[model samples]
Target chain A: MAQRAVKQERAVRTREALVQAAAEVFGELGFAGASVSKIADRAGLTLGAMYFHFKSKEELAREIVVTQPARVRPEHESEGLQHAIDITLTWAYGLAEDTVLYAGARLVMEQEQFNAPEENSHRQWTDIIACDLRAAQAGREVRRAVDVEAVARLVVNACTGAQMHSSIESGRADLPQRIEEMWRVVLPSVAVPSAVARLEFGQSRGRRV
Target chain B: MAQRAVKQERAVRTREALVQAAAEVFGELGFAGASVSKIADRAGLTLGAMYFHFKSKEELAREIVVTQPARVRPEHESEGLQHAIDITLTWAYGLAEDTVLYAGARLVMEQEQFNAPEENSHRQWTDIIACDLRAAQAGREVRRAVDVEAVARLVVNACTGAQMHSSIESGRADLPQRIEEMWRVVLPSVAVPSAVARLEFGQSRGRRV
Candidate 1:
């Protein structure tokens, strides 16, 4: 049991190191430019060890992309649920321009390093956010008229477009601030306006968005 | 006069070489990954000549970005006057993935690499479309209640998002078809239902949607 624990610890460390290196490589080189050799070099790992943990670069990238939502706080999640799905999505919007998030996103786009299965898996994970929005609409926290799938797709696209533009066009404005404002604006279209007002005024203190 | 003509010729060559090089580098390395040396090498030119013309990497990138809208066929100057403008802009909905337009847009986002005054030019271009939509509404070509600006932004965002995602996601699905269909569905909100019908049926004459 002690030996098993030791191996597990080593494996976790290796994985952390790999993820960190992925952010760096993807941040600088984008998904296409980053290679396994380069990422391994960045992480100070050998090819054999990288293979031991991850079957391929795609696996590592998907692992990172799938793991990104962990940054959302519990409070944010519950508040979003109370108000509507946009509020929850807004929380993740904060991470749009994050180096780690960008890298992980690029990895999903990096065709060579990963394959179709990995890409579809990431797409499925992305669809989860859309699913949540649809559920909120079904719950009547969001409007019934709007198409939740399209709105969810739009939300992700806006997040990505704004993130890329914000990163490359810095000094013009604060990205996080802009995103929050956008969320505030777009949220009304998807949200139950009364619910939002209630949350805004603290009328529904115990409610979920 | 001869010497001046020769100088102009050299300048044109340099300019073309720079655009071609920037496109190749930007396409593969992404905006952040590309450098002056990489572009210069790609163009088979010395760094000095590149600097002589562009002065900075940002300048070269901007030059490429500004020339991108020609692909749109200058809807503003079309022969159909205001009606043509509407048709032209509408036609562009299907051309969202045009390489030239995407490249130009990418350059605008890479504002750090192309800090020319026109860096935020896309905002105005988008506004131009919005204004045109408003004009159409005012002219009774559209519905009075539609939010022209919102729909314009939605269309632009949808196009850009589709392009970027499709480029990476391959089999990412056809967004233009979806977007065009969406317009048909949404037209009743802003445009006269008859106009929407005309858009669908080519207006009884030889006109085409």
Candidate 2:
């Protein structure tokens, strides 16, 4: 039993290494440009070992896309508007530092290359944001006049644009600033006047909890 | 002289056909995947004719990127906040109908594949929005406290995000609707109270003059 446990643990570690290497290659070279041998070499694993972990590059890409939001850490201790802001701020910083999220973002945009039939990430984000906005509305943090669903969708779309622009312009070094600006411009339409004044847009908010 | 004029007109027509064909190919296959021969064949022109108009694929891509904004038709008959709104509405429609703008938009996103360095489109967009906001401010159509540059950047970024999501989700069928939602969310921060009520977000606003 002890030997079996150790073997399973080794398999998990190898899978992780392959995931990280595949992310780096996919992030740099895109899905069509990336190759299995290149990913295995980058992971410092034998082809046989890599094959044992993932059957094909498409599987690896699907894994990355499906599991990416989890890897980016969307859970926040805060709730409502602040929660939504923190989630995006966290995402901006994550996109900057984490290869998995970066590659996942690229794959999400170029999803026509793969055959994953999952719910679109944009709708997923909209649903997440809408949930938070509903919470904010219950708490009186959000304005009654604001359309919760529309505001949520707008936030997701705006964040998508801001992150893309930041990546293209500054390699994402300015993503936090862009997110902060986005909230400032967007909050007036969604949040109550008092709530807007109290909410934070600091870069420190994005640091890992 | 008449014969010479006819030859010049034919040359102009051939160049236009080549540009249109190249845009379609680049839009569909991306810059790296596109071939000069394929572009010529799509245009129903010989390779020698294509070479006469464009020396290389890189040159064609550069031409597309440099000239896309002009092709998209940013010129607006209105002024102030309405003008800014009209410009975006027009763009949303242009992206849907104009192959050049559609391909130009793709090339702009994937520009690392080519080498053409002018001002970044985002900055150029920001400047255009700022100019419009300045005009709006001069007429008291924008709020006094609004930061024109920041708000302009926000609009550009939001539109970028909205257009991308629209493309991914519905093949841009809902782009005008998305842009309308963007304005509803963003206008409160930048436009004066009076101006906000008067703005239009119709899909018909995107139609040609």
Candidate 3:
């Protein structure tokens, strides 16, 4: 029983390593350019070991896309507009430093070519923001006239653009600042005046996810 | 003199056809995946003719990137925020139907891999928008406190993201609607109340670029 437990732990570690390496390769080379051998080599694992964990590159890419949303955790316990802001800021910071999340985003953008789930990540993000907006609306933090779906779509799409531009311009080191600028313009249009005054768009608020 | 004129016209036509074909191939296959032979074939021209016009694939991609901005023309003579809105909407609509424009945009997005000019397209766009915003600010079409640079960046990036998302989801058929939605959220924050009221977000306004 003790040996079995150790073996299970080892298996988990190997899988994690493989996913991390795959993310790096996919993030840098894209789906068409990335290869299994390169991913295995980057992970410091044998091809046989990689095959044991992920059957194919498509499965690995799918895993990255499906599992990305859970990686963005709020920095603290908050509700309404603050919660939404925290998530966006935290995601911006994470996208700068986390290779796995960055690769996952790239895959989501270029998924159509690989036959991976294209809308899963985008839809998940939209749903998360929409839910938070609904909460904000109920609490009177946002304007009564604001369309939650449109606001959510705007925020998500704006952030997506910010990330892509930052990546191209500065390798995403400036993503948080870009996102803050985006919110400054966006928040005023959606959130109520009172809520806007209370919301924070600082770097300190973006805790690691 | 007549013979020389005919030869010059033929040369001009060949160059135009090659650029158009290169745009289609590069737009669909991207820089790395595209081949000169394929571009020539798509243009219905011989390889010798293509070589006469473009020395290499890199030159072709660079030409596409450098010339993209000129393709986005305003639907009519307008100025201030109206002009800005027209450019964005016209660009969105043109991005849907113009293969040359679409390929140019893709090249700009993936310029790093091909050593193409990265900042030219973005900088040109930001400058054009900033100039309009400056005009708007002087005209009181834009709010007094709005940061022109930040707003320009936000607008350019948001449009970039919207175009990318629309391309993946609907082959860019919905890009105009998406940009209109973006402007609906963005203009309220940057433009003066009076300016926002007068801005047109209609498909008919987006003439062919």
List, residue by residue over B108-172, the lDDT tens digit for candidate 3. 66677655335546666888888989999999998999999888888888787777777777778
**Docking model 3 quality class:** medium
For model 2, the superposed segments whose C-alpha errors exceed 4 Å read: A74-76, A115-118, B74-76, B115-118
Cα lDDT, all candidates? 0.57, 0.82, 0.83
Interface RMSD of 1: 4.8
Please write out the lDDT profile of model 3 over residues A111-190, one tens digit for every residue: 77654335556667888999999999999998889888877877887788777777777878888898888889888888
List candidate 3 segments past 4 Å from native. Answer: A115-118, B115-120
**Residue-by-residue lDDT tens digits, candidate 2, B50-105:** 99989998888878877765665544478888888888888888887888888877
Per-residue lDDT for B208 in model 3? 53
DockQ per candidate, 2 decimals: 0.23, 0.58, 0.57
* Cα distance off (Å), candidate 1, residue B112: 3.6
Location of the lowest summed lDDT over 10 successive residues in candidate 2 chain B: B112-121
| Cα lDDT of model 1 by residue, B78-186, tens digit | 2211443344344334234444444565554445544544356445455656777876776778666666666564444445554455545553344444344334333
Model 1 native-contact share: 0.14
Candidates 1 and 2, the one with greater DockQ: 2
First chain TM-score, candidate 2? 0.91
The alpha-carbon deviation from the true structure for residue A158 of candidate 3, after best TM-score superposition, in angstroms, is: 1.6
The positional error of residue B164 in candidate 1, measured at the CA in angstroms, is 1.3
For A1-209, candidate 2 gives per-residue lDDT tens digits of: 99999999999999999999999999998898899999999999889999998999988988887786676554447889888888889888888778898998777666656743336677778888899999999999988888898888788877777776677778788888888888888888778899998787776667655
